[model samples]
Target: MRDERSRRAAPHRQAAFDGPGAQAGRGGLSSLTRRIVVFNLVALNLLVLGVLYLGGGRDSPLTQYRERMGVEAALIGNVLEVDPAPLSPGAVAQRLEAITLSPGLELLVLAPDGAVLGRRSGDAGAQAEASRTYVLDALGGFWRVFSGVFLGDGPLPEGQDPLGQARAMMGGLQPGAPLSRIAEGATGRFVTTLMAIAPQDRVLGAVALISPLAPLDAMARARQERALRIFALATLVSTLMSLLLASTIARPLTALATAAEVGGKRDPQRPAPARVRIPDMTARSDEIGRLSGALRGMVAALYERIESNEQFAADVAHEIKNPLASLRSAVGTLRMAKRDDHRATLLEVIEHDVRRLDRLVSDISNASRLDSELVREEEEAFDLLALLRSLTGYLGGQAEKQGIDFMTDLPEGEITLRGLEPRLAQVFVNLITNAMSFCQAGDAIRVWVRRRGARVLVVVEDTGPGIPEEALQKIFARFYSHRPASEFGTHSGLGLAISKQIVEAHGGVIWAENMRATGTDPTEGPLGARFVVGLPV
Candidate 1:
């Protein structure tokens, strides 16, 4: 009967999206690893572009020209200091001014105490001022280039020179401090280096070498733009690939889900639909491949279960037919017998055979309908305490006839539940009957109801020989009797199985346990089993 219930409840059709093979393809693309790969690729491209921007254009001729100008200025300063025919400061300043007339160099010379010793122009210390202005311009350009490349915006704050900011950021420079680059705006990059004149490692005044960063700034901006383009392209490509992958993976899963929904109402006569196959990703050993394998295995198992259930149903029908036919024939023979004594004996035999047939048919039928008929249909709110009181009263007579002490410990107040009353009654009856059957004279059957969280638990406990662990699970199987039929008389061994089905169908659970009576003189050995049924409130 349990097997039959499973069969009737099984979906009639292959699930539209049922197979694991289909699901494997559907979810594989959205996994974390794929996302990480795309992220890392984009980051690497940006990093490569940054490295090139910083180092690639340093060897340009414009940079060399700036370096040569600094060298020429230093040589002229030395020549003007020569003995016996050295030029005056004004004459030296004029000579330096003559050289800068060529192009791209702003020259100035400072005395040891920060005074304007010589200069290319005389605009009230104009050469020194021009040199300082160039340094500020160079710092601004570098700041602009650096900021644009990194922050995607305008220059650093005005007023604070970029080179000075860099110096401050690096914790105030000493002589020969390393050259640094900073951005001035979208249009410039500044290179700043401290030039120190020293005699035997004792430092003289330092020249802050400042170069206009227009060329490097342009290159960096170009590199930054290129990096953004590459990143955008990579992102677009990765996104497309992810979508394609996700679709490939999700399609099979969606198909499987659809198939499962359809299968729930499918007719058994039609063959199960073929499982959707995932494209073989065997060239790669990854989650997708594993998922595909799992899906295949699940489909195979489903097929086996269906086939097994079909064979089992056929076997049950075959097993019951002969016994039923014999019972029918025996009843016919008993009715026709003429001698009274012989007729009585035949009648007894017929009765025995009829009982056997009744039990067989009942158990088989109940097992067959277990899943469907036991399913709860009409749910109504009812007091569990009241229900137990009524059941105890109904079964009290039967318990008394067997000389068993029937008692109840139902807690006061309504223990309400949302469930089918008839199904609940059936479950209670089955448990009470089983306890009554096993209980001896003077033995007790205790029925109680208690509330637990969102569920109401009804426990039927008895004092009798406890059920063995080995037979515990099997006791709920169709025609599975723990004691011999001869000892209990003929019984359809489907009561517990039916009770289990009903409880489960109502979204409840039932389990049995052997417990010792508490507060006894010496805790008694395990008494009869306790069956606990829980139903949602």
Candidate 2:
């Protein structure tokens, strides 16, 4: 039997010890840490992409290159305007080339008659040679595609370089103002600045400065590299911080979930497992901490209830056995006895035992079902004083018939309370009747109520032999009785226990104490037994 039980409990035992990793194996409570880190990294990268796009569109290196080229072109036109020598194609070209131009610029001089004078390369000849390398061409191609997609610009037209494009625009046109434009090239784009070299409005000629956009492309690449490096560092830091936050949340919640799983299983035929301790997170002062405290409290209540039920069952068995054994002995005696009077006495003994057994069974069944009934019942506001008046009026008549003084000191007007009325009525009824049972003829029983702050107190006092000091705490426990010998078989011990269950279910308290003559003398005999019930009002 032991081996079979162990086999049945093996899985549950394993479940109790399972950690978050084990739960994750079963796809339970997935890692919030991973999700947090992933989301932060993704958002960070998106922000970087947006910054790159916006920065490249409005304030790009290409824009700066055009502005610089325009300034250089204006300066060159000024230099040509001051020269006093007659214009010639060779002279124009030679003079222009002598003036050092910014790198990657090509200079062209046109005659006043619209004849092609001459063209001279600045530093462009060397740069053009370098630009033809496979590596440079490939890098320029990549930059062109990248700028096209993200910066809302497209590739340059085929078969057209910046020089040819500028010459075409300058043909058959007389400039009235300094003009700047972008021209496409085979390998890249260019910034072209045009200025009329007309000294004193006589139109000496026009000088065209064409600057390659390769340097701007390099600037853009460098900018992008820096941006990416910063993004990577930010992503790393944000992801680590997210992981730490997730750990604070996920680990404690996981522990709580695991504890709930282990303790929450209900098996009627099996004994309860060892108590599971929920992790204490109450110091956090957050929602998770509140949840932890609530769960711990719930588990404590559940274990206490389970232990109480186990003890109740054992007590039930023991109580029933006493009556059963008495009846059995009585029956045997009745069968052996030959005298009529002896047989009659044996029959009465058997009857009393049978009655005792019946009472015990009835009370046991009611007590067993009390917990569920208390949970299922709904509470409503009612007049507490009115309910007490009704009980005292009805039970007082019964006390009078038994020659005992029944008194009530109930206050006037209604004291309102919210609770299951019938259940609370049962509680008061049990307290009054139990007190009456302890009292004899000529003894007095008093039932009274008093309001104290938010609570209403109900006291039941009887002028009978007070309970023993040792039994005061145990009086409300199931099957615990302190009645006289003659009263033993006549009453079941569940009345006070059931009363306590009902009172507590309504968020109230019930306690028994001996009423003494003076406040503090332990040697003095108790005047009577007093039962006090306090309920929220």
Candidate 3:
């Protein structure tokens, strides 16, 4: 009764949810998928951010502006060295005014004494004022970028324009002077060139040329913006696709977990459900699909075994009750018997019942352990011929003592087999013993082994009466027995069942059929019973 309760309680113990998901409502899909989606999104964001920072900050395309400024400064210095003495600030200004130049260039003329000569706006300076405003905006971008770092976001310069400070850094009225300025995001940039106006080998007035970088900076900024937009769009698409993949992966896994939970759930206060139907997910072409199939198969086999065990237990109880009742009846009758003959008969019946009970209990124990042994025992190659030779040599004497003829027809060469050696030996022993028990004096029992293709066959045959036609189909069922009344209580019918179990576990087959002579009459009986066991070589 305790064992029965424990067997039913096994499923309940399996369902115990001391794990974290026990308290949650629906943990299957979200639990696994959320982590995947979050990790992918974080990685995508980092990649885009890294690309943008590197593309815009230190590796911008605006370096070309500085190179052009260096060329312009060199040109001015060469021209001033030609005639410095004849070039007054006024003459140089009048000469500069007559010249056509770049639209973004501005000239700041100064005398030898470092006094401003002709600094007022003209055609070139007029063209520059608008670009100068652009430079101011670019400076604002730089200010905001580094405000928290170098500047601490302090007060802005009151009267000084950002571009004016950039120009002042180039030095005033200095000949052959070169300068460069650029801002972040390629928003604004410029270069300054200072030249001495000399007509002779004397120092004269100086001329400054300022070039605007508005057009080039604008182009670079546009290209950077376009690149960033493309990256953002690609990132968005990638995230959506990642989510789809996670859902595709998670849905089937969720179904599997849900099915397992349904099957395993058991309440101590109530019985478990009779069956749980697992959802089939084998259609998918991936590892998850294989996992689902394997789990379904494992669960199905487990339930089948459990049902078989329950049926076997019930059968054992029914079979054991007969001998137990007989034992009880004999014990009761022995106390009342008075005559010597009556006492002797009662004692003989009691001993027979005791032996029968002992045999039945022994068979049942071996039958129960067969399944576990077959699964737990390691298999190895052994010489089938050697194993058979040893067993037949040992058991031939017992057959002789019973007045039965015993012989073997095993092949001479080694017949190697891979299986549990002891278990196979047990099977052969059971079959040979069974044949010996059924044989009569002068009856020949032959044991033979032969190989065909990939399988080896072991046959044990007896010249005793063949199995009754009616019992052939049901003979391998547990506890099934059919014998003459004289042989009753002498054998427990578990031998064939245990033999079949062992054979099948080794990927082999065992079957019995009556051997008939050639050209026999239809009404004639079988010559003998033949049991053939086929095992893989």
Candidate 4:
């Protein structure tokens, strides 16, 4: 039966785990994995851009270059103005030779009428600074065009001296006033400042200082290239690491799901798989491990329940067959009997068999429902002493009427317990009644209760013919009856089994023992049968 059930259930279980819906869940990248990689890349790329694009402070090279150009232009104008050498080319050249100049600078001097006076070109360092590699020059050209088109960077005239353009733009100059501007030159961009040479409110000529912008552009391009290399490398490494991490997580999860599905697969030759061996991930110390452990336990419990049900069904079949056979025999014998006394005897046998069968069937029904009832019922706190008092009070009179002594030794205060009240009552009632059935006119049945540390113990002892040593263990088994033939049909033998089930359901234990006259000697004659029940306080 269990095998048939498992076989029938297998395909449905497999479909639940491996169907289209499950495939869909496994198809795309996990959201967590996507978020991990994407968010990391975004932050890293943003940081790279911020560091590259964020310009320098006031003390940057460009600001210092502008200041230096202005100071140099003013110094040149002052020198030419104070010369008193008639502003001749020879005098200006001699004066320029006497003044010190910084690297990467070109000087232009003009007469008051806008005629060229003298020119002092840049030194060797400025010439070296102007040189560029093929890659850099191409990149620079592309950048200029791109910026001009998209970033609104205006193009400078290709074949002109930027200082000359500055001079042309500033037609008139005021004394002691310097003007600075950036303009494209024949070679590259230049930062130029024009300062007027004047004395006593009289305007003379002007001196213009020019510095190349190529050095700054080259430095920026080199830094940007290095930054881009780092960004690309970082993104690649991070992406690979994120994917590896995601695989570690998802692979194990997928394996677990697959294993779970495999456990439910149907085999034509076998009832169930040898075992549903879920992967043992308990050592992982994570939620997956805990889940694996929980699943393993549940599967084990389910198999145990299945086995128990199969055994129960087999036992029920075997037990019902005996009375059914007897009933069939008695009915067949009755029709053949000619005498009335013989027919009457056959009828009595049939009635007895029918009653026994009815009792057996009723007990089996209750036993079958016991497990579900224990699970479905709710437990509440109740006083154990009060429950016992009510039982002993009602049952004691019945025992007295039957010429048997019924005694109870109950405790004083409230013995509170949390459990199904009616189920527990059924257990004690069964125990007490069984003791009563064994006892006669002179025999005594005593029920006692006591608290034992963390647990409460209840004992039902009977002073009757004690249980046989061989039958003691088997007495609690299903359909196992050891009563006298006179009371054969009165008891179904399921009472103790049901009691054991109820006790175990409440996390308690029940056991039967033969009470000996001497505690230390095993050879001593048995005095009575003792049933003990222990429950948590």
Regions of model 2 farther than 4 Å from truth:
1-31, 57-159, 167-187, 193-209, 242-301, 400-407, 410-414, 441-443, 519-521
- On TM-score, the candidate that comes out on top is 3
Candidate 3 weakest lDDT stretch, 10 residues: 15-24
Clashing residue pairs in candidate 2, if any? none
Which candidate order results from sorting by lDDT in descending order? 4, 2, 3, 1
User: What's the CA RMSD for each of the models?
Assistant: 14.5, 7.4, 7.2, 7.7
Off by over 4 Å in 3: 1-29, 53-60, 64-217, 268-277, 332-338, 400-405, 411-416, 518-523
In order, what lDDT does every prediction score?
Answer: 0.62, 0.76, 0.73, 0.79
Q: Pull out the clashing pairs in model 4.
A: none
For model 3 the TM-score comes to 0.73
lDDT of 4 by residue, 406-425 (tens): 88899898999999999999
Model 2 weakest lDDT span, ten residues long = 13-22
> 429-497 in candidate 2: lDDT tens per residue?
998888888888999999999999999999999999899999987888777788788787888878988
Model 3 per-residue lDDT at 482? 84
Candidate no. 1 TM-score: 0.46
Separately for all candidates shown, the number of backbone clashes (residues 3 or more apart, or on different chains) is: 36, 0, 8, 0
